[model samples]
Target: MNLEEKLKQLPNDAGVYQYFDKDGHLLYIGKAKVLKNRVKSYFKFTPKLLPADKLSPRIYKMITEVESLEWIVVPNEHDALILENSLIKQLKPKYNILLRDDKTYPYIYINLNEDFPRLEITRKVLKEKNIKYFGPYSIGARDMLDSIYEIVPLVQKKSCIKGKEACLFHQINKCHAPCEGKITKEDYAKLVDEALGFIYNKNKLVTKLNSKMEEYSADFRFEEAMKLRDRIKSIKKSQIQTGMDLATNENLDLFAIKAINNKAVLVRMFFRDGKLASSNHNYIKQNKDDINIDINEAYSRAIVNYYDNELPLLPSEILIADEIEEKRDIEEFIKQKFSKSISILNPKRGKKKEIIQVAHNNCDELLRLQNTSSETSLYEDLKLLFNLEKTPNRFECFDNSHMMGQATVGAMVTWEEKFVKSDFRHYNLEAKDEYAQMRETLMRRVESFEKNPAPDMWVIDGGETLLKLARDIRDSCGVNLDIVAIAKEKLDFKAHRAKGSAKDIIFYERAGEILKLELLPSDKRLQFIQRLRDEAHRFAITFHKKQKRKEDTQISLLQIKGIGEAKVKKLLLYFGTFDNIKNANLKELKEILNEKDAMLLLNYFKNLEG
Candidate 1:
């Protein structure tokens, strides 16, 4: 239907409304209590009645591109709010305040369903029964995890039980080895609870680290003491600072935003059971295609998007830095998303106001640090793009190179903050088919956990099929590794009917499905993934060429039955060459070889050496 005809049919019920451009690209997603009244407001305005300045530049521009309108009728505004947020994340429309991030905050998870639950780190906060999750720490998540492992004698590796016998880790007391029945499930449950206690009471872990540092110093182990001191510093740096407590055991979240030079930063602080647990900060920027956003509007957009799209702890009270226009509307959203009452308040005075002020101060300092640097950290962009659990410190890229089925090889290049040529790995493959080659390559790579720990992320050169094989290898070997695949650039440029040209694309898991990056050639994401694919291809091709060169000159002596390198060496040493060995009789061959070897070799070369 056309714009006017569709607008005439708007229902009185609440719902999410979407505006689309002539070309069908989404312009905006919005929620309304009364669909007819809100949707009709746009047509009611005229250039003379509402001047350009009175209508926000953003709204004005959005209206210009809006050639058609569509909406869903819902029972209440709360449902509309959630639907709108989901649509925004799913479509990523041009006019929405896209909540781009530098990193995905990490949360400490302990699955209570398992008999012996161990603490682990993750980025996704899923809603599941018996899966208890702790802080979404902004920094030092690894340090915190390492600190917890020091005091907790729990399962350390994902694939801990390799065989019937206890491994060295159990012998060294690092693991209780529940796989081998060293500790009862009940006893391990107690240790898990102790570890959870440490998570709540982080001070205990800090104290233990301090004591270890002092012991090392007293023993004149300065190197060990220094390492301990660094760990302590990381814990302190990443921990949430104290603020004016509400003096109640209520769970709540306080948000404070600071806007400068048309840019904004929103700081979210968590308070559970009257304790300040942790806080996270993110910057808000206007898309180049969209109009600039005001600080007040940005605050509203963040509140709706944060809770509706990114599922966080449902707080009883949500305090804001300033009065927002959609305060009651947001409260309705929280009520529906989480079946509980929420107070979206702008406190004027007292302890609650002080909490808001603290959050504001945090943004001020964070903005300063952000501006001092020329750009955000490289790892930060990757974390947000791929939705990884942490700033990926260790990046390993895999590529398989071969001409047909001969001289097959697999290459892995490592990058830790920076590329490390010294750590590059090359593998010779035995499989003839592509899928088998990938499976065998990955199986051999992750089979040895003690030799090489799992990296934060693995980039493979192929599509979803190859990436799935990598995941299977990880699961069978019991490792927590993140695997993503980059599709090679299409030889035909017309494949880019939408993105302008053929470019290498990255495939990563988001909201359960594998998502292909909608990237352009000039985009930083395209450049970053292209570099990894190129490096892997270069290493694999180099290794394949070397293997082919060696194979070209050598005879297929290794293929002979019952004749290995030692037997071949003895024959050559006695007869001078392979030709000479082929001219020898069984009596002459038996002089240098054992009976079994001589008979097998003589039978194979009967016509030449009989």
Candidate 2:
């Protein structure tokens, strides 16, 4: 449809909308308080407001598919919020902040049913259970058990400390000493109720406590009033001094986005009840754009995409670093989605705005941690470490095995990136030779690659002879490829020889010295090659064992009486296959056997042979 025609048809209402490519693939999913107004704004805006100026070329790919737009109308802003979250997850729109990590933060769960009411940290949110959870906090050094040390006494609950009078907390009138039976079950239940209220409704609890302190002081209960004052101070001290203050709602989500030279860091600070749950900062790696674009639009896309995929527990409010163009729409959408009217505030002064500034400071610290590491990308390291002109995107390794040149077999393994392709080949030699077996295996590998060209590097698990054979096969098959070899010390296969450790294996390329790769012990490329070599060795040995078992069984049958010399040779020649002898009937065998020896041979065949 034409831009004007589409805009005229759109309804001015709250809803979720999907933007699709020419091929009908969903590019982005978003919600707006006024569906008609929001959808129309895109086409109406000048070239300066185009997404092409801000997002990278990778993102621009989605813009070509703007052939059609679809919308799902909802009753209110919050309904739009819920629908947007559900649709984005189902469709997994391309132009969105993908949830990179699949992990949940831990929350401290208090089992209200338990007599002692133990507190434990859990990853699951078991909503069906009658339990209270607080703080999806950091998996930091301070264990959740440590919370019990202060929490148990703070609530004046029963403890296991026995055969003693009231503890100092109770003597000082801070605790009711339920362990010593000084407090009744009814009174203790009241304390439990207060604790639960404080956990889930921190701001309200603190407000009530403050009021109680004021009333007690007015009644001249100085000692009682002083205790409440200290308790309030203690709770405040536990929180991160982010300088963020909310009037009645302590549970809030604060987001701060900073853009410097087109790069951005998004800081999300989560507050639970009244305590600091955790703060997470994510940096967007965007190349500096040629056209200077509005930073606010970039920030808006970042936040929307993040929340769309994550859909973390909706907070009572969101504090942004700056004003966004779709501020009203985002606020209404969030409030409806969370089933609570949440404020989207840009605080001018006081604790709320300070919280955003604190989030910004935390952003600086996050950048330091991410960029300081000297570790190289795994693929790049592999390419340099192996000294290959091209990266080892598809690498092949080979190994040979035999029991004293008997039942010889060769195996070829392939590595693509960091993964070993297990479905490769293990071939029987047919000829009783190691060099010939290596030649046959290499020939097969080259031929296979020729038929199905997976143009890449090769890693042979032998020295000069094997490497040369592999190259010859590549030439014969007319398959040009890069190749390397890892040869173990000759003594590695000797009988009664000590087993070789990692240090014993020498990594040899076609052109370089066969040195211990251990010199570059820290190199990721060498480590990857070592794993491939180990895998090739394992495959070759396993195939060789099966070949040996079959050959040994056939050779063992040659020793029986009347199954000797010419007769045995005749039987072997007539059977043509070893498996036939295993299944041959007595009558069928009698025709091949001499008459006098037929009976003896039948008895031998019926009985188990060595």
Top lDDT prediction, candidate number: 1
TM-score of each: 0.56, 0.43
lDDT of each: 0.73, 0.61
Per-residue C-alpha lDDT of model 2 across residues 202-282, encoded as one tens digit per residue:
455557768877888999999978877776665554344564445454787777766555345677777866556656655
Candidate 1, residue 318: how far the Cα is off, in Å: 2.4
The residue pairs that clash in candidate 1, if any, are none
- Model 1 has an lDDT value of 0.73
The per-residue C-alpha lDDT of model 2 at residue 354 equals 67
Cand. 2 TM to true fold: 0.43
Poorly placed runs, candidate 2 (over 4 Å): 1-94, 99-104, 111-114, 122-132, 146-249, 272-275, 285-316, 375-610
| Cα lDDT, model 1, residue 437 | 84
For model 1, residues 354-376, the per-residue Cα lDDT tens digits are 88878887888887876675334
Worst lDDT 10-window in candidate 1: 44-53
Q: How many clashes in each candidate?
A: 0, 7
